[model samples]
Target: MSTEESPVEREDRWVLNLRGMSVTKITVDFRLMLFLDSDWEVAFDASVDLSYGTAHANPSVLLSPESQGVAGALALFGANVVSAVAFKSGTLRLVFDNGHHLTCSPDPSFEAWQVTGPRRWHFASLPGGDLAVWTGSGASES
Candidate 1:
């Protein structure tokens, strides 16, 4: 008996855009491992403008205390607040209200992520030279 082999393929990519006075967009390319449950790898591009405000500002405030705390911690960490909060490394770290912290890191080859707390948004340079907004949640708008 002869057996057939399957070929590996690239995964699908998804883009999300939130538009209003401020515009936010994100594109994600991910591969799901068919053999493993809940196993996946992803590349993401995100961009956001907090000049306006988010769709869920009030709700976001109610749901995230970590947002407020992280803002303060970021200031202490010497993160520049004016135009956009920016850090040196590929990893962007923030602490939530509950004291739980989350870090987002892009691949080393990609440009560093730019975060703006005063504007309450972030963006990264995509491989294709496009910008993607960060939308992890608990982001505030000034």
Candidate 2:
């Protein structure tokens, strides 16, 4: 599929905007996810609020030595992520340039991150009001 997408595809849940034009910065906090913002009003993917602290800090976001330097791994997201990976432990990783990386795993009790459209994200509610975040790859019969 062409990376070209209509503006209408932007969803309402993703309140944050990531222009896709050279990521300016990334913020990781007690929140359950990593977020990036760019230079425009365009929306990209994933905007998770880290308020209540209801989520566990499972999985992990690690930085290589080069990615951990004074400059930080910020520029790692400057270019498109080279590859997106899902591990057996339910941890997901986004690989960037210079070997920098970011990984996260939701506690089994927490909703998994689901990507519906091409890199588009959505939340799927399970029974009893629980959620299974969609990790778009791995462990499938594709």
Candidate 3:
């Protein structure tokens, strides 16, 4: 589909404005889930990179439960999101006010990450690198 054909639709990439939303809860089972202020829930199945406490000077910590450094993700608890952006290639980048930055990329053969938010807005990184998005209203889908 094309934007000209549907004004409410987005191309392949989009940004999520999650500023001011704090991480209220963190859950780790088969996947890592971060709840934001009771409004948004983000789940990551693929590897995630977390940069905390001097972002530019320090290397990001990998937070894949199957691997080491997953515990570093806990630092995000109660941290407010300063900016969140989703790339067309299925990358979710989130910057936190506490000098933390998180990035989740899509997996080649599996759904990597997803987010559910207020007003029934839902977005996911599909297997093989694509985006699937749904919103409560046509206006919000963009």
Q: Which clashing pairs does model 2 show?
A: 112-132, 112-133, 113-133, 113-134, 114-134
Best by TM-score: 3
Better of 1 and 2 by lDDT: 2
lDDT preference between candidates 1 and 3, better one: 3
After superposition, candidate 3 runs with Cα above 4 Å error: 1-12, 53-56, 66-69, 137-142
Tens-digit lDDT track for model 2 on 60-80?
333322223223444454544
Give per-residue lDDT, candidate 2, residue 38.
Answer: 24
Which candidate, 1 or 2, would have the higher TM-score against the true structure?
2
lDDT for each residue of candidate 3 in 1-142, tens digit (9 for 90 to 100)? 1112111333656767577888999988878899997478899988998887666689888898544337888888998888777766778888898999988888898878988876777878777766777776642322
> How much does candidate 1 score in TM-score?
0.24
lDDT of 3: 0.76
In model 2, the Cα lDDT at residue 85 comes to: 39
Per-residue lDDT of candidate 1, residues 1-142 (tens digit)? 0021211111221121111112122222221101111111112222211111333542222111222222322211221111111223333333322323233444445543343322233444433333344444543221
List per-prediction Cα lDDT, in the order shown: 0.26, 0.33, 0.76
Clashes of 3: 0
